[model samples]
Target: MSTTWSAPGRVTLIGDHTDYNAGLSLPFGLDRRTSVTVRRADEPILRVRSDSPGAGPVSVPARVLELPEPPAVDGWAAYPIGMAWALAQAVPGAIGPFEATVTSDVPVGIGVSSSAALEMAVGTALAELFGLDLGPAELAAAGQRAENVAVGAPTGILDQTAVMFARRDHGVLIDFADLARRAVPLGLAAAGLGVLIIDSGTRHEHGTGGYGQRRAECAEATSVLGLTSLRELGVDDLDRVRPRLAPNVFRRVRHVVTENARTARVTELLDAGRAAEIGDLLTASHASMRDDFENSVPAIDAAVAAAVDAGALGARLFGGGFGGACLALVPTDRAEQLAAAITAGVVAGGHPDPVIRLAAAADGPRREPDPG
Candidate 1:
């Protein structure tokens, strides 16, 4: 038997560095996705391969029940390997011998949650192949398990939740405190605006980057502030807490508190049909990510600057922000010029060629038809 599963990569419009603090985030899945095609194997072995973002392909041989500890593999192999371990735990007796080919356009190392997409796709495909029951939420939890334990990243569930739950015409407003989410209508497309993702051409492996350090700082600040999480604090509470913690930790907490409010305001603006007013909030987010969180890169800044000047309604350095793409809200008619300007600016600033993708809100993971 053969089966294919697909899940879209996600982009965070605002609320960076807020997820781990139990704050709010606004993320939407894109049309681009990672798909895994699995076919039964006669040798009682499980194998995996991918054509994107890595040193090379991988082929692991093992029984579904006796899955080994996730090996420390090179490049993109760890994501699938880690995911396999998680899936086996979720559906031990249901899995059997199979080989998978992973294909994806959502570039890894650029912070679009490609790892989560791959994990979600693999989890869902394996469930379907073996007749195991798994819902999107369970699959998302499985995906997060892979990332945290096997892959060694302390990321929150924002990306996985967005991938599993968002609608085609909206962004999921996630309150990480309780895992309760509501879909906020993103009618930008209906308002003659388009969302664009421009890769700044730098790679960030979340496990070994500034991401961990920032998370550590937040945890430390939470202890010093006497709060359960940053979610307990608000923008108005920052001034009072500012003098209590170390300078850097205070700034990190500040980003979380204000960013949570920003996410809500972005939702309000989207609801009010005032897509253009979001530009300041987007730019402010970039500044906070740069100044307070100290996560922005020069390539991303250049891309955002050029895109906004070109015609975008708003643009911000998206995702985890050490080095990744920027998301821009632009006039649908001027997307080409906006992309061109970003490319030209990055090139002029002496960076690698940037990649630009235009996307709309997309549905969550689903089973693809059997191949013809």
Candidate 2:
């Protein structure tokens, strides 16, 4: 029997760097997704292949079963290997004797949570192939574990959770501390608007030093202020801790504090059906991330500027932002114009033509190959 699985990538609308701090986050599923097809084997070995030729076939012995240590092939196969290793812990004999092929449209390293999408797809495929009944939350957690332990990135749970559990056409407001979630209806696009993903084409690996440094800096700022997390701080509290922090730490804390407020405001705008008011907040968020968080690279800044110049309602650098992608809120009619302008700007800035796409919010992961 053949088992096919798919999971969507995620976009964080607000509350960046807050999940790990036991705070709230707002993430929505994207239209782009990854799919995996798997079949059972009897030899107790894992065989994997991908559509991309550079990512050659990889065969891992079931005896090894160690994550992050899969045979060093390259590209997308690492994602499946990592997922299998992580899933093995949940279902002791589940990972062995499987052959899988993976394919995806979620652009990697663009902060769209492509890694999490791949992990969820692989995990779901394995569960179907093995006749294991795993819940959506458990699957998301497993994917998060794979990314953290197997991929060596200490990321928060927002990306994985959103991809696995959010609903279509809604933004998931997640309380990370309590794991409570509410699906807030955000019919922004239905109101003659669309969310544009402007791929800067400047890759950012969360597993690398850049992301690690930001996490550490945020933690350091929290420690210096005697707060458990940056989430504990507010705009009013900045004055009290400003003297204790280095300039950079102070700036980082400022962004988090302000960003938390912005998230609340944006949510309110959506709830009130005042989508136009969010434009200013989006621009301010990008500015803070660039000037204070120091995450926006030149390409990202250019893309945001170009989108705004091209008549976008709002534009901001989305995701981790060291160098990935940005989001532009444009009228549905002007989406093409904004995309072309952003592409031209990137070319002018001596970068590759950005991959621009209009992304509609979508549902999270669910069981597909049910064995009835």
RMSD of each: 1.9, 2.6
Among all windows of 10 consecutive residues in model 1, the one with the lowest summed lDDT is: 63-72
Q: Candidates' lDDT values, in order?
A: 0.84, 0.81
For each of the candidates, give the backbone clash count: 0, 0
**Runs in model 1 with CA error above 4 Å?**
53-57, 61-69
**Residue 243 of model 2, lDDT score:** 91
Q: TM-scores of all models?
A: 0.94, 0.93
- Please estimate how well model 2 matches the true structure, expressed as its whole-model Cα lDDT: 0.81
Instruction: Single out the weakest 10-residue window by summed lDDT for candidate 2.
Output: 66-75
Which candidate ranks first by TM-score, i.e. highest? Answer: 1
Per-residue CA lDDT of model 2 for 323-363, tens digit only, reads 88899888988888778888998789888888899988888
lDDT of 1 by residue, 1-372 (tens): 789989999888788778889988999888888999988878866677887655465666664345456656556777777777777788776677778888888787788888888888888888888777888788788889889878888888788888988689788988889988888888887788888888888888788869999999999998987779989997888888888999999889888888888889998998898777888899888888888999999999888888877778788988887998898888888888888888998889888889997888888888898777
